[model samples]
Each structure stands twice: as structure tokens, then as C-alpha cells.
Target: DTAVSQTPKYLVTQMGNDKSIKCEQNLGHDTMYWYKQDSKKFLKIMFSYNNKELIINETVPNRFSPKSPDKAHLNLHINSLELGDSAVYFCASSRRGSGNTIYFGEGSWLTVV
Candidate 1:
């Protein structure tokens, strides 16, 4: 089975639309995160969860939200989507604490037109 899985590998939406992406991991990791990769290939962490608790939230727009039901799952919801929101989102997991190898999902590509 895949260590981590994300739903709707591709998403196309119009400005102001609302969307959500779901992710799950079977790697038994304690921490999970959401990362965004822009068109120019710049990667940035948007949010992080440790054992189902919100831990790290970056300076992302208020339109983005991350939810973790358990240590193995993390989901992202976006409201009032904008063209700047277009990017590839990646779900990742790692052991609790810091300095651990993180595993990533294939990525959910979001496009706003």
C-alpha cells in the first residue's frame, strides 16, 4: 500500500470557488504537513500537525485551512480561491519531534482560472 495517499490528484476551479483536498498516511508517523509548490518550483510549508493537533501554521492566507483527524490523516480546505492559489500541494509525514525523514504524497495540483 502507498505510505501516503491524497485524493483528487488534479483540481480545476474558478476564482472564489471553494475546494478541499484529503490525505492519509499508513506510515505510522506522528506528524503530518501540507506543502505547496508554485509554478516556478518554489516549495513552502503551509501547515503542520502533530498527533492530530495543530502545531505549525505558516503565513498563508486565511482562505487556507488544514485539518488532521488523526496522526495518519491531514486534509486541506480552501475558500474563495484565487489565481495565486494555483499550485501543487503535497502531503507529508514524519516521526514525532524534529529531524526525521519526511515522506510525501504524489501531490494535488490545483489550478484556478
Candidate 2:
């Protein structure tokens, strides 16, 4: 079983459309996160959750939201998608205080046209 899994590995949509990427972790982690890697491959943290509580939130637009229904799932929803939103979104999970042993999913590639 995959430790972390995300759906729709690739996505292409028109600008102004709304989209979502679903993620799940079976590793029983206490923390989950959403990270974005731009075309330049510079990775950045968009949001983070610890046991369903919002922890770290970076300077991202309000159009993006991270929803966690439970500790095992974290979903990323984007509204009014823009061309600049195109990138690989990664879902990761880790046990808090584990010292850098986070597991990541395959990543959802979103391309807004």
C-alpha cells in the first residue's frame, strides 16, 4: 500500500475554473502538507496541518484552500484557476517531531490555460 496517495496525477483546465486534488495517507501520520513546485522547480510550502489543525500557512492566494476532513486526508482546492497556478502540487505526510522523514505522493500537475 502506498504511504501517501493523490488523485489525478495530471490536470489541465481553463482559467477561472475550479479544481481539486485529493490526497490520503495510510502511514498514520499526525501531520500533512501541500507543497507546490513551479516551472522553475523551486519547491515551496503552501500549507501544513497537524492532526487536523492548521499549522503553517505560507503567503498563497485566497483562491487556494486546503481542507482536511481527518488526519489521514488533505485535499487542495483551487478556485479561479490562473495560468500562473500551473505547477506540480505534492501531498506529503509525516509524524510530528520525526525529524524530516516525510512521505510524499506522486504529485498532481495542474496546467491552467
Supply the TM-score for candidate 2.
0.97
**What ranges in model 2 sit over 4 Å off?**
none
Q: What is the per-residue lDDT of model 2 for residues 1-113, given as tens digits with 9 covering 90 to 100?
A: 98899999999999999999999999989899999999999989999999999999999999999999999999999999999999999999998875769889999999899
Clashes per prediction?
0, 0
Which number leads on TM-score?
A: 2
Q: Which stretches of candidate 1 lie over 4 Å from their true place?
A: none
Residue pairs in steric clash, candidate 2?
none
The deviation in Å at residue 110 for candidate 2 is 0.5
Which 10 successive residues of model 1 have the least lDDT summed?
Answer: 93-102
Model 1, 1-113: lDDT tens per residue? 99999988999999999999999999989999999999999989999999889899999998998988888899999999999999999999999776789999999999999
